[model samples]
Target: MTQTAPVMRDPGEDGRFGDFGGRFVPEALIPACEELHDAFRDAWTDDAFREEFHHVLREFGGRPTPITYLARLSESLGVRVYAKREDLAHTGSHKINNVVGQTLLTRRMGKTRVIAETGAGQHGVATATAAARLGLDCTVYMGELDTQRQALNVFRMELLGAKVVPVTSGSRTLKDAVNEAMREWVTCVDDTHYCLGSVMGPHPFPWMVREFQSIIGHEASRQMAELGVGTPDVVVACVGGGSNAAGIFAGFADSTAELVGVEAAGGAAISGGQPGVLHGMKSMLLQSESGQIEEAESISAGLDYPGIGPEHAHLAAIGRARYVGMADEPVIEALQLLSSSEGIIPALESAHAVAWIAREAGREIPSGSTVLLNLSGRGDKDVAQVRDILKGRS
Candidate 1:
């Protein structure tokens, strides 16, 4: 196969990162998706739209997120570790970044409703927050299992006036929730914008989602430069549908930085799975010989997924990133270690990357090599689950 120059993109038509991404939705939803695509294109190019979006990010979503050096972690790992604190965002997760952008576009498109899916409920909460702020009706679809697991977030969404619809289909988790959300979007496409939480999905979604999230990498790059570190030697982030990782990797794509995407070993799609379709996009997925999506196992509710974003599939195939896997045990260990050592407790989703640094890699990342990890969210959402793990609850 011949390698071609990577394609840079405009927002609408067919959203792609290379040939890997395209809108592959149900026929009924195509026009709605196209409308969203066009709206995002115009919004992205409009200075006023850009200004309003940035203004919200600055005042509400917390723009210019800080880069914190983990001195103790660095001393222990032999690498200068820094964390891009997306966890510090208002909703305590990076999911708000995309939610804010999509909500703005939703208003611009004259949409009166917002629909979304959630795994850890971070996205649901983020979407609900945006909906409440914009006074749009919001509905969040979550797997039954997730609703139970992330009950606090479910209540949080409800408290914010968003309805949480519990889906009990398939594995009854993130994937099922995604299917439900898509179905709802198909039915209500005229008045509903599906606020996708990740850089996966089909076509314009992955592209548009990444554009919103690019703020992370963009701000981090500028901050690092100001700190007199031109570029880090490595950029690390945990990948579920690969949004946060993509966000942090986008700005550094042209630099010499070694991008690393950490996957949950129990559900390590890149290292353990084949290319397949799920939730409308084709990518690496843990699947059976019969091509059914396999059940994923990760201590982190957010990091367990059968499929990844298509661009991540492309990146993994092309060696643009070093994808590594860390199992359940080490992820727990990292969560505990971070809490004890640094007085910082990270969401288990983000801790999966910290696990890679803590135990997965055979050697410590080299001394003086600056490594930036996208700490995607706070750990408050996972306290109950972690307590269960600690107490040996099933």
Candidate 2:
């Protein structure tokens, strides 16, 4: 997750990113959020703290994952395609980067346990791994449906000594898992840190998590320059809670590159959403006219959230970045195409970016344009689910 550093458009002290991001949590958690804000502020400025974070990411979690040029796929699409290979990072996803930083912050805060919400379970696995390494108790909340769909990841988390609690509330998916986690966090805010999986959530979380994940963009920016590619024409990544996209976008926000966030068609908050607040942040959400948060359905469990990170909403509002959605049909086709052409299978969430590039090539993307796609996660955890879906279709 290492990269060259770039200045980000950080929110004000009030955490408002142009009317999009702000704290909207229960009173009980305000003190905790304040404490986290202060702690992060201090730790982020301290050279020692920054060194420890990078050291752990480099030595324990794999940092500086390579950027691979998709030669064949580029030729087929009539665009030069390159992938920022976060799938090769520890725990097989970009989830490891934020968790590693958060778990370290947890230890610094003298917390003894970590609680997290997961949909596809990569965050859970990464949290469990970091907790085990630091000798802290780890518990993961996942929707009952996601537990069934992502059983392999559940097993992986348990193997790493995490307690997996299957949430059985509304929808039984990422949204429900978040509800359960937030409820649990209120009860154990003193002794446990709620390790939010994405750049959503309240106040410092969206900002803090983006700061942690900015390594992706920072590194990719420098790496692209080193390869004589300079800045790309477009930078694309899948957006669930939008952490990966935020991370990669931070690298090129000030550049000439166009930023595009691809979302699951059924859960596209930025494209098919309204202004609303959910999970403590005011962002674009898939909600009904009555302001009820709708259940987001997607073939990718990780991208099944009802809302996007607040910063993403701000970006879209200001015309800094554009977002689009991809249906399941083309997403599946894109995954197969990448697997066969590049010999690299992407997680269903990550495949959304590939799907967008493949479908938009020579159309919205222009011929001979250089495209940078964030390969956010690997397909190992999704292989079984994809198999089931493919078999059922057959």
Candidate 3:
């Protein structure tokens, strides 16, 4: 196969990637957004700031998460399967990568408090951990339903010294939590920073978050070279707001590796959506023909959202990355398969990618090809839920 590098460019001066991604936020929040954008731009360029960020990552969040070669799974699938083990990071997921960067940025901006929204609660836990470590106040908004489903994570955040607010409005899921968090940030913009969990929000957020999370791909690429594995034939990661996917993709974006993003079938914006504006950005969203945002349903709270990050939308539009969806049953089966075969249980969100590989490895992906799957999180928090699901099935 011929190899060509993708055209890599930062979002234009308007914070756009092609026709996707822009500051579609309320006029009242524009100044705050601009301030954040400027601060991030300046901080990102400073060597001292970069050193400090990496220092925090190494000393606190556990940087350079290893890439595990799945020997048994590889033999079973007739392909070389590897997992970039973000689940091994502190806080049990890749969410900490962005949280660490944002927390430092908040302190630099003279903010005393940080507020965030979460779906599966991983980001909330991560943010809360950073806040506690930095001695900053933290608050997290979670959908009522998600808080119930991910009760352990909710408690974990509270234990980390964050106030977890249950948002009961709208669909009572990630989107609603985001709405409430944005409202709260608007009221307290003077002293509080909205630490968006994903790469979905307006402007510098998508850009800023991606930069922080790109450590995953950078480390993976370097590790691969050191191990003499070269680049994999494909790179795969699950996408909610596309932080992990975007992060890992960033490393191989300009390379020949095929980038694939797995989304929950019940909430796949790119596969079953149209262009619409939601949560302050223009991206493919699961919306009604009348333009109302539809409620996305999925067993994985982290992947249960109506829209994706704008960069993922742009990548799909430009054929730089392929987006696929997996239903809940296959994801559950994949979770079990990985647990039994490799002794590694992945988060339900990450299981989407594993499920795709389980179904398509030898058929769609050629035999003997190489595949890198971003094991985005551990399934410790999801064990009870999956156990109940499997018990019901039996």
Ranking by TM-score: 3, 2, 1
* Model 2 weakest lDDT span, ten residues long: 1-10
Tens-digit per-residue lDDT, 266-367, candidate 2: 999988999998999999999988999998889988888889999999888878889999899999999999999999999999999999999999999999
| Per-residue lDDT over 291-393 for candidate 1, one digit per residue giving the tens place of the 0 to 100 score | 9889888888888788888888778877778788887888888999888888788999999888877753336566556788889988988877788888994
What TM-score does prediction 2 earn? 0.97
Q: TM-score per candidate, in order?
A: 0.95, 0.97, 0.98
For every model in order, what is the number of clashing pairs?
1, 4, 0
* Per-residue alpha-carbon lDDT of candidate 3 for residues 192-307, written as tens digits (9 for 90 to 100): 99999999889988889999989999999998888899899999999989999999999988888999999999999999999889888999999997999999889998998999
Where model 1 places Cα greater than 4 Å from the true spot, the runs are 1-12, 360-364
lDDT of 3 at 106: 96
Global lDDT of model 3: 0.92
lDDT of 3 at 361: 89
How many Å off is the CA of 353 in candidate 3? 0.6
Q: Quick one: ranking by lDDT, best first?
A: 2, 3, 1
Worst 10 residues of 3 by lDDT: 1-10
